[model samples]
Target: MKLENYNVIGVMSGTSLDGVDLAHIQFRIKDKKWDFTILESETIPYDLTWVQTLKTAVDFSQIELEKLNQEYTSLLASIISDFITRHKIENLDAICSHGHTILHQPHNGFTLQIGNLPEIADLVQQTVVCDFRVQDVQLGGQGAPLVPIGDRILFPEYDYCMNLGGFSNVSFEENGTRIAFDISPVNTVLNFYANQFGFDYDDKGQISASGEINEALFNELNNLDFYQQNYPKSLGFEFVKETVLPIIESFEIDITDKMRTFTEHVALQIAQALPNKNGRLLITGGGAYNDFLIERIQFHLPSIQIIIPDNKILEFKEAIIFALLGVLKLRGEINVLSSVTGAETDHSSGNIYQPK
Candidate 1:
């Protein structure tokens, strides 16, 4: 296949801390428009040890983190190679990865995303584009919710695009300007509590459905200062540890009750971010699988139309968006929105690493 016609693979590791998602996508631009088809997709769950390491990676020392980054890059490369071989993939154009986020404190003038090492390109022997956020952050941006650019470009029919991943974020246009922001923590806190019960997640939110809501704790979360902040803001693991965890821990609520209350907290925060009071909202991400959580959100925001797409879209939307980001970067078009990220300007971002 020609380079323009060749297929690309996009990778995403979300905050839900679920696992790495790989989307083998065929992308092309014809008549000044973009089109894509997901040829294959898969989620590779993290091992218990890797999960623990990534969970605590934010606090690691510089030396230790540098070492970890190299290892993570190697691991990502290995996985991509395995996926390609297993699927008998040929004519690969490139691989774009939104590597696992490690640090996103952009206000302090720094952000880091591991697994962008050149070793990945060498291993996969394909053009690679990764680390799409640092440059935007350095240019005075939030370094987050980058998917809105893809949402606007690829899935523009909906009035709002709400993703209930590890974090809840919504993207919509207002006054003819695109805007998005992180509403609150979602699976990040939910999965944390779920681990206490020896399960990776609360399947269909069974535990939360069985628990009672603690009004006090729910109110505390709702009253968070971040909720009062304006749009173009984002969240990180640090926010959970500092703002959310402390507030939740102060309450003497049972684990199930805490889950139920927090689920409500997430639902309300998400509902509040919807721009149009009565238009359709396209919801995706793993949290969409949480029946109880969705019910809570729907209950709170009855005016909005919540539409969940196919299972593949729910599972691999981030990876799919990352692929679109790569396409934008390759074409030198704007991939990160200044309106969304508070960047100096909207611009294309990502560093391409060609195999040696």
Candidate 2:
């Protein structure tokens, strides 16, 4: 059946290890366009144990990773189930989850998002749509920034949609086709140093604003090979661990100085990444809350109009988009775009598992 309406719980865990984000979203087709209401949403912050586990899972042995996958999937199931029960949700068609990306190297011909096992369906007592990235990589795509398709449909008003999460990515239409790619790391790098200071994050960029930028480090960051690479490229935590961290750590600067420099680096890179042409840019994700970062971005791109949405849309936008992706998959519509992810073709990408 081609249903015109869907009520689904969109779940997500990001590279920054913030927590599981659950959103009960109601999506409807109105006049051949997509409309959505965020019925309810909350970010369930992870405890230290889980945070530590996910932090180091990228380097786990194959067998160890396999075990961790099941473990994490079980946690995901419980989290989703708890969200539904707590919210008294009764009209769910499915649970759409992004799972957590432990390893996202599409160039290496593989990518893995843990907590996407089929068992989650039965455990949560609902149909499941998940593991949305693997198939795209197999098709020779970057298998990332998958939210662009959602941006094209749900946020057609904006000329560009930029997410400032673990990694920053921007999506926009060019010559009638949608284009998007990762520009740089945001919370992923900031949170790492923040943790060293016994803080989960730099609240409102306070710690960073208190320090100074290291010019040499900032210059090297600006000239990195990744920034020179053309579109159809994406980043993962591995990039921070392998390439970015080593370079940053090689300097003997204070942690606060590193944070300050990186924050400045992020602002400049984002401004440089966008086209010189003017347009309304929608900024979301945790980074949008960093006032210092936004100020720097505004300083760099003085003419661009930046939109910071309400808290619901800002935090739950990705979750809502994943829900839309699940609905598209259910309707057999193309949820992954060739222009955005560099896939061979635009196609429906996700695995649907019926509950046992």
Candidate 3:
């Protein structure tokens, strides 16, 4: 039977490797419409060893990846258990996890998200809904930017919803269909150079602001093939490792200069993607805190209103949305939109496991 209300835990680990986000959410159907509240949220940072393992997970052989998957599943279960115990959360209808994405090559017909093992349900002693992308990919979609469904339902007032996590992606309604696509690499590229400076991140884009943009590098980056591609497209770490990083590295410049140039590239690309008119662009994720980057984006799109939500919404929106996806799945409602991901059809997509 479909539930009128649900208490769920949403989990997410982005490509930026910031940490695992956990959100205790209460979702309910009020007056025939869905509503939600984030009761609590936290981010659990990965230790150095786990960081290294996830960073190179794509290079692992099948057997190695399988082993790593098991390890990650165990680790994730422990994290979820701790969150529940610490919060004294009870009567959870489900735990919805956007398992850490290790490989996402939709065009090559495969995507792997670890920490989605069925045993997670048994370990956490809760019903689990996870591995949401595989089915969408099987339906011939990009299988990304799934959060847009949440955007449509949760923040219907906004004209655009953009996330600046590992990459920058934007979603909006166009011609009555929800359209979304990745604009450019964000933290994935920024944090890489930040690591060279022995920092996990640039700390509010200060490093980039300290440097100057390289016009030549900016031109080259803005001309990348991905930028020219139409909507319903998405980015993966492989694209960054193979296409983006090499271009940035080939430039003989200081890390700061690269950061500045890339930041400009990001701002320009985002501006170019947006419609040149008045509309609210709701920005979220780690990059929202990057004052310099946000300023640049604002500078480029002066007419459009940019809205950065509160800290919780900024950081945990993706996790919160994943929880909503699970709720929709539980209701047998469509969670994956073909208009956003180029799927064959809109469908509910996820693997559900009952506690053993």
Candidate 4:
């Protein structure tokens, strides 16, 4: 096999709306195995206006969304351009972006991730690979949890790779194929309740630790239909805004109580999702910082050891993996898994746009 290497920037804006994450990565395949180094990375937090706009984008009309898409494409171009300039990164291949998802109702045969337009290549003066989820949705798949392929390639030592992001998802090798799916909502639900208490997030799960878990609320959250669904399923902001919040709001419980009950609910759901009880599980994403939340998860499954990587890996793993996805797309290899997304087949899924 011939040797190849790629230097690219991976950009991601997740459902939590925390910010756009950009990472400069160097990837190489040696002896048919992949290796990577995250060179430079920074997260540009969304401004208040952008945050509010994205938060309400689910209700946007078709025409309004079209307009928003054009504007967001420009926004992404600027962000990617500045990151390259600031890092003085001149040797580059392409920018792989998981553009923010505005709508992801795969069960209805639709998903939208804005900020991926052909013009981004020209504006950033680099090739771009993005819109990674649409093709999977078209193939009768959930079109999410795309990072699992990355987990399999980059961090295969762990028995399971779990991301506690806007939603929680896990991926692992089962038999000869990779199996993965979204487990439940995580920071998406926690941060919302945290914001109610005048904080961006529940630091160290402090608010939840102080409050009491409402048993009724806890039971309802645990019993949600999505939790009972099997693999290849996904959860999105729509599920949170539509199904989750309303259920939580129906009760006249204290805000902290809501937070506590939901935290326990998150732990229980995660514990129940795993198939193994005695293996190392690598945990990453923002919610990994929630000490109390981690404690609860450990409380439920003491046999499974959870490993937290270094800060850079914990923070930029998704960005780094998307960089790998772009390399795979460029190489015409499979980046999205059928086993993970329930697609008709495992396929290379992304759009590549070269600078004009």
| lDDT of candidate model 4 versus the reference | 0.92
Clashing pairs in 3: none
**Model 4: what TM-score?**
0.99
Task: Give the per-residue lDDT digits (tens) of candidate 2, residues 129-231.
Answer: 9999998999989999899999999999999899999999999998999999999989989999999999998999999998899999999999999999999
- Report the backbone clash tally of model 2: 0
RMSD over all Cα atoms, model 1? 1.5
lDDT of each: 0.89, 0.93, 0.93, 0.92
Superposition TM-score, candidate 2 onto the true structure = 0.99
What are the per-model C-alpha RMSD values against the true structure? Answer: 1.5, 0.8, 0.9, 1.0
Clashes of each: 0, 0, 0, 0
Q: Give the alpha carbon lDDT tens digit for every residue of 140-177 in model 3.
A: 99999799999999989999999999999999998888
Winner by TM-score between candidate 3 and candidate 1: 3
On a 0 to 100 scale, what is the lDDT of residue 184 in model 1? 92
- Candidate ranking under lDDT, highest first, comes to 3, 2, 4, 1
Top model number, lDDT: 3
lDDT of 1 by residue, 16-112 (tens): 7788999999877666566778889999988889999999998999999999999999888989999999999997768989999988898897888
